[model samples]
Target chain A: MRDRIIEIIGTHGKNQGALIPVLKAVQRMNPRQYIPQEASQLVARIMGLRESEVYEVVSFYGEFSETPRAEHVIKICDSTVCRVNHHRELVDILEHTLGIRVGEASRDGKFFLEYSPCFGACDVAPALRIDDKVYGNLDRDKLEAILEAYRR
Target chain B: MKKNVALITENFHHYIPPDLAGYKHFGGFTALKKALALSEEDLIERIEDSGLRGRGGAAYPTGKKMRQSKAYQDDIKYLICNADEGEPGTFKDRDLLEQDPFGVLEGMVITAYAVGATHGILYLREEYAHLLELLQGAMAAMRREGLLGQGILGTALDFDMTIFSGAGAYICGEGTSLIESMEGRPGRPRNKPPYTKAQGLYLKPTLVSNVETFSAITAIVKHPQGVFTGYGTQKSPGTKLISLCGNVNNPGTYEVPFGLTLEEIITELGHGVAGDKGIKFVQVGGISGPLLPRACLKMPLTYEDFDAEGLSIGSGAVLVVDEDTDILDFLDAVAAFFKHESCGKCTPCREGNRQLMNILKRMREGTALPSDPENIQRIAHTMKYASFCGLGKTAPTALLSAIKYCPEEIFMRRGQ
Candidate 1:
């Protein structure tokens, strides 16, 4: 992981401007999907940025997680369009199925549910992103099918 | 009889094959080739004459912005296509990028030439990481064709572009904050005075424009025969692409002339509200935009008309709410979005939005006091005037506009 962090930092030139990309690359270095303390320290050393400064970038953006996450992440759209299109209903259904709230991960470490503000997929309202793939115009059956596939 | 001018969205209905040849076959890059022949000053002047404003809500004149960067004598100036289309309800840019990547690229290359910029960046939102592979492949094709590399199209003008994905920060849509994020920092707005055109990116002169605005430039430059100005009103000429969403029947990207009324946009373009629901109010812009009551339905969509009514054509996001929708619930969602996206940089935005969110939550739970609306208005006033940037300044727009238009609807008694 340490050597990989160095290589990622090198891939993006070792400069103050390269800090965000380096942190993003390092976070994707593991299934945990977080910038570990050691990785933050390594990024700080390579980019000549303060360790706290590195942590600031990670915490500021909602995408950068600080800890281990579930295997498959499900981000339900919570923006105005989706909300009016009954996103809350979807949230309720997901909670009922996964036995977790909007911000919680299932006990089995299989899925994480979150309220994402506008993924720019407003054309297809009531959208949700399972990992990186966005499924729009979602109904209960479609949501179940998607989760079922992910679960398998 | 005005028609939906298909300059930016002409080939939208068809699947755009992700290559330069595919784009060229659909009348793409033709404007760029013509633009390359014109001198930089002439190119800037032509766009200035067209009255094309920044499509990223502010509506600042595009040519004037490019001219500011052109005035600066920097050897390594930058051009950025602001594809960080995170504004809720504004999916027009995303559609433009997906449907016509070459049109946007052509706009960027031409804008870079006019502004004397050698390098460019497309600051795309992280959620649209799916489009990165297509954009990367398109750029490679452009490079091979010598259109993106040194001496593009056999001219001394040299320009190239790269993509930088923003990691979920709505505040990054603001120009300076976008630049700060590109520098690998937390996307926070900087105090203005040294505007980005003079000192931006790596403290170099830069030309940053919205994706739709760049796409518009391609259309504007392509038609030297005044076809661009033929559509829309005099003050606000050209077709404005609207991301028509919410309870509307045809909820999709629709390009309409600027002077079309809210009624026409909703009824004609959007095919009316879904399920035949009675229209209540419309949020013309994104979350930060003012809420227009049904009384203003006849109002024109021009910037002049919207500005006259103390509103903006912010990213052209038209969200129509039906009569069945609850105003308080909508406001609660809006408040939550602002609170969540607040960068917490300033006291007015951070503390003010938190207070606003708590009040809305209390109201939703039927535990609010009668004086809370007044309190929300007070906080909104401070955030509008005293807050740091556009996000803070415009955060209270919907709440205040709702109060102004439908006071009885929003500030209701508990359990009525």
Candidate 2:
């Protein structure tokens, strides 16, 4: 996680094309890790691009993170129509099985969760993401099984 | 656990009428039936007293706009329902327009009567064509039953609604931009102060409300003088509809009270993270919202929650950035999008976003000076100060917020 962040910081100083590649390289390391603050300015000087360009790229998308996250973060899709699709049931099952509520980390620090407005997966109706994996049509049983992976 | 909040699904599994017969069976328009009994001015007063705000991204007071438009000079006032779901992480309005069309229609018609608008328009996003069609069919159904167009249920309120779809432009979601688009102009935003109440759409007085905001008014119509005993906190009441997605066992839409904490929302509503890999951080309230560390999840999901986190409660967007995920590239993608979308209306936003992207690129490619952090901060601050519209002003929010949270990773030296 740390190495990738460093590598990306190196790329932000290159030409314009290097911006995305550097970022992608860092993302490959770990979405949860903090990106070094100097990466943007370095990128601008190297690529002959403006610092604002780097800022825009970093801020516009939902995937980037600038800090370290908890051991587990849960995001539930709660779009207006998703409410009708039983997103509540998913939240309820996960919350109950884990014995914790949304946005709350488990007592043992095994889990953390919250509601997400959208993940761009509407066809599945009710779907989920475990780390980077997407799981659809999940119930309490599936949810529990999924959580078991992190028990290690 | 919080005494159970109602998650009224506008576009979930099913909440609308298959036919007029079905609508009446389900209590559709009962609010209108009750609201039609009062004078338009009286209806406005009730809404004002209710202290309701628009559900769109702006969160402006609904009744205040209605009251102001009441005195505009022209009789040709317009009531535009902004069903344009342009925001990337937001799809709430489409849910209401597609599933619970009547709920939104009842509210819009009543609003039309109150604001003295003869014409109503639903400015929808092109991506939601299927939803738009569903709404059109509902409108035709409403007209067939005499519920719309010149008097209904023996009342004398005359209003007509039409759907005008917008081409792809996220900026159009802005109220003034929507007005400009509706009037056959470029979808760029105008300066505030004159506001939509004083001059909107065809240069006449106009009142614009989002799809969900208008639908809530239907609930208001039913209650009229009735009051909601207890619900959300003082500033924001009633249940809020949210689309939850990303890194959870259950990723979909649900409703909860206003002050729900991020922790409670995910654990209770979203279940736990899908995989045990662990959650490192969260981006609540979408792109314009703040990027939060796991530490802040315990706070309530209200305006206060955002303020405490140094973030904004934007458009009800809540996203999760799971463990072992890359923060730089994700930021890179966001930067690229802004570079493409910046209207270039102002030099600061136009040039600032571009320069930031360049700097980010150089950093990613290992080509910038050691002082990249200071440069990034200087430009980000400039964009915040000089951008003309919310699009520009808030564009750097996520990046800056993330930087504040994780300056080490963002500023890490490669050779070290």
Candidate 3:
């Protein structure tokens, strides 16, 4: 873990502005999809910054999560465009399919559902992003198919 | 019966992205070639004459920003393409970046040359992280063909660009906050006066522009001397990429001239509301922009017209809400967005958005408080005036505009 973290830091360098990218890479590397305490401390030590500074950035942005998450994070769009398109129905379907609420990870830890601001997918309203990819114009069946693929 | 003009989006549906050969075939880097031949002063002057404004919500004069960045005497200057399209209904920037990646890159290189910027950063929002591979592939092709890095087209100029991902902060869309986030800090807006032009992105002269603005710059440079100015009104020259969405038949990005009415945009371009539903109101720009009722649909989609009506063509997003949608529901979403996105840097925004959300929630829940509507206005006004940055200042625009356009909807519930 130390060697991989060191390798990530080596690529980004120990520059002042390299912290955000480094932390993001570290979070992506973790299987649980979070920046664990040890990883944050390691990043702080290698980047020549205090632990609070690292944690401050982690807590500030919506992308980073300190606690462990499911294998995939699903961010639903609850903004105006999506709301007008009845995103709540999609949210209900997501909860029913995953058997978890909006802010909870599935029982098997396959998916975590949370609300997100508009991610520029308004053209395809009622959009949700899974990890890096966005799925929009979603109906219940399409969403279930997507989750099924991720479940496997 | 005017048709949608296709300047920046001309090559959108024509070819698949990351295809360098196809992009060049569509006359991609001809602007860079044209811009390189002209002197820096000439390039800046042409931009000034073109009358292009920032496509991001601010609508600041793009030429003036470039000239200001150029005026600063600095060894290292940065040009950041603000692709943080977090504005609720604004997705035109994403479309431009995805469809015409080369055009945006060409514009950045030209602007870097004009402003004497040493390095450039494409500050892409993390939401669009899927586009990183395509953009990187396009950049790699440019580098292979001698279009990026060191000398470009065998000239004395040297400029290179890299992508910087934003970590889900809406306030970072502001120039200073963006710089702060890039410098590995919390994405919070900094105090101005030492503006980005004087000191930005590691405290050097920087030029931050929207993604669509850069695409427009490429078009302006490619066809100089009134050719680009032939479109749009006298005050607002050139077309705007309108992200038409929400309860509409065609919810997509359309590039249209400035003087067209919102009615035409909603009816002709958007094919009216979804299912032929009657229109209730339209929110031009993003969530921060004003909410215009159906009566105001006759108003032209120009900066001057919007400004005359005490509104702006913010982010060029036209959110058409049908009569089926409730005003309180819309306002609740708007309030909730600001509350969630407030960086908590200042009291007015951090607390004001909270109070606004609370009041709206109560209003939605039928909790009786006659003072809630007035209190909502009071808090919104405070946030508008006393908040630290543009986020806090413009945060209450939808709430305030809701009161102005649909007072009965807000006050009726409260029995006021």
Candidate 4:
């Protein structure tokens, strides 16, 4: 797994500009979908960036998770547009169904729910992104069915 | 009456993005070909005469920017499309990238030609990672059609672009910070003396404009200045793409001419506020923009009018609020957003946003200080005058404007 991760990082090249892209590539390689401390150290050593610098890149961006993440990450839009369009209700539904509040992973490691400010998809208000795919104009049943697919 | 200029949003509402064939069919690269025929000076003059301004909220005249870059003598010049659409409510750029990728590329092509830039970079936000493949495909198609590679369209000029996805940072949308991030550092806004136009992107002359600005450039280059300037008002001579959201019935990207009144925008294009509720206020631009109460609805949505009213048409993101909404809650969200997104390089912005967020949190819990509002204004004033960049300077706008216009909601509010 480490070899494969390093191989993926190599594909991004060893330039300072490759730091963000390399980190993203490493995280995607991890099944837990996060840049583990060891991975960060490896990236730091290989890319000639300090460990502290690598960690700074990791923590500065909201997308980079320090700890292990669940199989699927669900990001609920928390901007004013989503808020006015009952985004709170969507949060409540996800929390109730997944048994975890915002920013927490479900106990079984099925989902991680977090509030993202805006996905730039306010055209269809009340949106959420489960992994890479964005599902907009969400209702309770639609949300339930979408989660069910990921669960299975 | 609402007038629409469909240049930026030509391929919207379509199932698939406009591929090279589709883009060519709709007169896509006509601008680049036409621009190639004209001398570089004339090309820049056309843009200057067209009265196109930066659509990335600053509204600086595009012609002046191109001419400035052209004046600089450098072996290597750069043109960057600021597609890092991280503004809280602004999604018009996203629409441009998703729908008409080639139009934006063509704009950058013309810009590079006029500025004598050989390299271009599209600084896209990482959250829109899905669009990377789509853009790469478009670029590949352009290469195959001889539109993007060396000596594009059989000319001596050489220019091409590659996408640089920004790691998640709202401050990166700022041009200096974006250039810093591109150079492989934490995204922090640099102090201005050597402004980006003069010394930018590895200490060379660079031209950075928003995605929508580039799309408008494509249109201006394709047609005559009279044709491009025919739609909008005299001063603000071009249509603006507004990302209308929040308490609006028709919430989507709408392109309207500059003279449209805010009331007409909310009613005619927006289809009025959602649920037929009375409007409490509307926020023009994004989170960092001025908030106007219902009384100012008749104000024309122009840079001049908004500027007179102590507002800006920054990013053209109009977020409407209804009567039932609590202004305090909105302020809390705005404060929190600035707090989270502040680059923390300068003390005034970093500490000021943290302090503002803390006070708003206290207000949410009914434990705020009596002097909290005054403190917020003071911090806001200090940050406005002292902070390093636009992020800190404009961070306090929503709260300060709320205090000025809708004090009844913010001041009298109690427990959650």
Best by lDDT: 3
True contacts kept of 4: 0.62
Best first by TM-score, ranked: 3, 1, 4, 2
Off by over 4 Å in 1: B13-15
Q: How high is the lDDT of residue A134 in model 2? A: 55
User: Which prediction has more favorable lDDT, 2 or 4?
Assistant: 4
Residue-level lDDT of model 2, residues A1-152, one tens digit each, is 44444566565545443454465455445434324447655545555667777665555433334444445656675542244345678988888888988767777765667554434444354665554455656677777777887777
lDDT score of residue B297 within candidate 3: 97
What TM-score would candidate 2 get against the native?
Answer: 0.72
Worst 10-residue lDDT window, candidate 4 chain B:
B10-19
Q: What is the C-alpha lDDT profile of model 3 across B1-416, one tens digit per residue?
A: 35598887788867788888898888889999999999999999999999999989888998888888889978899999999988989999899988898889999999999999999899999889999998999889999999999999999889999999888899999999999999999999888889999989888988999999999999988875786789889998889999999999998999998899999998899998999889888998899888888899999989899888889898999999999898989988998899889999999999999998888888888884878777877888899999999889998898788888888877787543
Please list the C-alpha lDDT of all candidates, in the order they appear.
0.87, 0.67, 0.90, 0.86
Error of 4 at A7 (Å): 1.7
In angstroms, give how far residue A145 of model 3 lies from its true place: 1.5
lDDT of 4 at B92: 91
Q: lDDT per residue, candidate 4, A55-138, as tens digits? A: 988898878899988888898988877887889899989999998989889998879888886778888889998877888989
What DockQ results do all the predictions give, each relative to the true complex? 0.84, 0.03, 0.89, 0.72
Residue lDDT tens for model 2, B1-416: 36235434433344444355566666777878777878878888888876677777676778888888887867678899987665545555656665677878888888888888878988876445446567888899999888888887767778888887654456777889777655434456888878888888767788888887887788766653534314577766665667565566666566667788877777778787767547666666655666677877888766555566566666675666566555665566567656665666788888988888888888777787778778888888988988888777777776787788877667673752
Mark the regions of model 4 whose C-alpha exceeds 4 Å error after superposition: B11-15, B414-416
